[model samples]
Target: MTRVCRLVAAALAITVPAGALVAKPAPKRAVAKVDWTRTFGTTSAGGYVVGNPKAKVQVIEYGSLTCPHCRHFAATAVKPLLANYVRTGKASYEFRTFVLNGIDLAATLVARCNGPAHFFPMADQLYATQPTWSGKVEKLSQADQDKLNALPQPQMMVSIAKTTGLLPIAASHGIPTAKAQQCLTSQAQADGLMQMIKGGEELGVQGTPTIFVNGKKVPAFDWASLEPFLKEAGS
Candidate 1:
């Protein structure tokens, strides 16, 4: 019976250290992946920052809300910048509002009225809706324009924001009418925005969409030109 059992076991190819003939291979380790795109922070200067805070490559842009060039940059770069670079935890992006005029000031005020969480999303929407709002501004009557120019900065900003059809955009993006009113009417907030313009000038930013990579200004202003620098920076 023992002889027969030994032969059967051999034939069946079943054996064990305890029960098995072959050892199983160890499982591969899982790498933890993080999507830094959804991570938003505020800089000491109040600019909205996105991505891995400690990433090697830091990107900064001094941009105007009303600038066509800045709108184009938002249209082209926001997605890729957040997804390819920021998502991988390789880089960070910061956008500082540089107000260029009354309309720009009003837009910036309203865009920031909600909170840091809504800032970027609102900025994306604002850029997407730029043409519609700007066109409305151009269609303003001469007398109305003169009246706007005559008013003080705060009230003028409120008027421009309303007349340019920008207030509705703000409302749609989570800013209540009362909040938008407060943003446009607040002297303190308006001064804070003016400080942004001053800060941009101090950085020698002469135009809209001025970008800095790793603390150095890149000569290129658009996304296509900026992508190569980001790649070279390990992004």
Candidate 2:
């Protein structure tokens, strides 16, 4: 079996809810759900934009693909927020990735593997399962980091892609052939990522899953704390 299938099976062994059968690979559907034009950017490191173009509050989330905190936010908070706010034109959302390590870069490449249409869905899936893959490095010793760091870029990407439940065949089909590889090695994308990191720094965002509403930081993770800020912005 491929590495991806192995990682996915390992994850399912743990998280497959009681009495529920393992979920099969979803159907290969047309990329119909996304508003492609809105996702466009002048540079290579473009992100998906969802919600009302005219919404008063613009929320930009700086996430790392390998970050467990980001996964929790995606699985536990983002879905509801998107349904309640983004879909209703009350808010707009943008996801920017911070590639602090090779694993993060690999994961980012995979998330963009399926283009804009599958970007959000793939991102949600990766974050939901992040805990399983983000193994204990401190306990394992520095050798573990070396092993991860030693992998060739292509191999590293394939490994990260595996952890996200994507088969090699699926990646081949979904990812733009040249773009997939290009997105990883591109200097332009790297610069864009740096800018995002610096932008977050300037905004006083100190951690993963940090949220900003109308240029003001929401100091907590829970939506209840953030809702008040939204109300204030919307008003």
User: Which candidate leads the pack in lDDT?
Assistant: 1
Residue-by-residue lDDT tens digits, candidate 2, 1-235: 9999999889878865675876778899885564322442222225556666677877767778777777777766677677777766778777777666766776676566555556776666666656545443323457755775577766655554454334442354466545565665555655666777777777676778787677676764656666677778888
TM-score of each: 0.86, 0.66
Give per-residue lDDT, candidate 2, residue 63. Answer: 77
For all candidates, what are the clash counts?
Answer: 0, 1
Candidate 1 lDDT, tens digit per residue, 151-185? 99878888888888777888888888888989888
How displaced is residue 210 in candidate 1, in Å?
0.6
Give candidate 2 misplaced runs (Cα > 4 Å).
1-47, 113-115, 133-148, 151-173, 176-179
**C-alpha local distance difference test of each model:** 0.84, 0.64
* Residue 64, model 1, lDDT: 85
By TM-score, who's the top model here?
Answer: 1
Report the C-alpha displacement of residue 79, candidate 1, in angstroms: 2.6
